[model samples]
Target: MTMNDLQELFVHKLAQQYYVERELVEALDEMARHTTNDRMSQGFADHREETRTQVQRLEEVFAALDRPAEARNSSVLEGLEEDRRELESRIEDDELLNMVYLNAGMMTERVEMTAYEGLTTLGEQLELGNDVQTPLESNYEEEKSAFRELETLATAKDLKSLWEQLTPS
Candidate 1:
């Protein structure tokens, strides 16, 4: 509560966002290894690098305020973690793997986009301008981009001959 200005809350939310994404960075690491598809594995690996930079940006945000970033777990993250575990078990089948990974990746990116947007709005409400806003906005866009990538990959699915018996419609 010590951050009197709204910009501080923006900083706080950014820090919080950092925590969630940091967790995702870890999850994505495991997810990357689980993926048999070379493209999918590489995608996760590349995103992990981006995620590291995002955490560094958050650290800069914290330093600007002379505060150390303290992480608080967002409860919703647990659900994503559990789903990913389930996903690991299901990935042996090509059909299930593609669809499940696409669906799971899309959902996780959505959660991140939602969380990042919430931070951006909170920043705007507090009269925070471009300096604080820019990085958050970039991160938001990254998640959105990931969402689109998964959708594109989803289009390759076939109903028949695929193990899942479901088409990519």
Candidate 2:
């Protein structure tokens, strides 16, 4: 396929998201293991499963477009993962770490939400119809929901004592 217009750009964008979803599955698994908070840990694990479904949906979208279920390298996801690693290494307090992790998740969800929203819009613009747009919109809503959950976790008051307990004397 010749690289030319918005349609081609949209396909490439979807491919990038496909890669991002795969990357996130692994990242979320590791995050689930690292989190001290049970709820947050479970959230990561649940989202890992959701991400797998999201990837399959992306493949379906590609099928509808008569394209291979391909993945392009996602530098954005790579950078976010790298930053997460650095943050984990630097934060010592378990509660603080949990809060930081939730914040990081929210950031990641925002990026995914933005990408899905744009892809949904692009699918509409290209007249790809609801077949493509519907899945993208579904993924967008999932991301949004995840972001809200992360926010609630980030703000919870019960975890504050964990931070204080670990505070340096």
What tens-digit string does per-residue lDDT give for candidate 2 at 1-169? 5789998899899999999998899999998999889999999999999999999999989999999998998888888888988988998977778877787798899999999988988888889988898888888888898889887776666655565665687
Q: Relative to the true structure, how large is the alpha-carbon lDDT of every model?
A: 0.73, 0.88
TM-score of 1: 0.81
Clashes, model 1: 0
Q: What is the TM-score of each predicted model, taking all chains together?
A: 0.81, 0.90
Worst 10 residues of 1 by lDDT: 155-164
Give the Cα-based TM-score of candidate 2 against the true structure.
0.90
Model 2 stretches with alpha carbons more than 4 Å out: 160-169
Task: Show model 1 residue runs off by greater than 4 Å.
Answer: 1-12, 90-95, 157-169
Residue 35 of model 2 has an lDDT of 89
Which candidate number has the best lDDT? 2
* Residue pairs that clash (backbone atoms under 3 angstroms), model 1: none
- Candidate 1 lDDT over 78-121, as tens digits, reads 88778767776765776567556656777888888998889879
Write down the RMSD of candidate 2 (Cα, Å): 2.6
Listing every candidate in turn, what is its Cα RMSD in Å to the true structure after a full C-alpha superposition? 3.4, 2.6
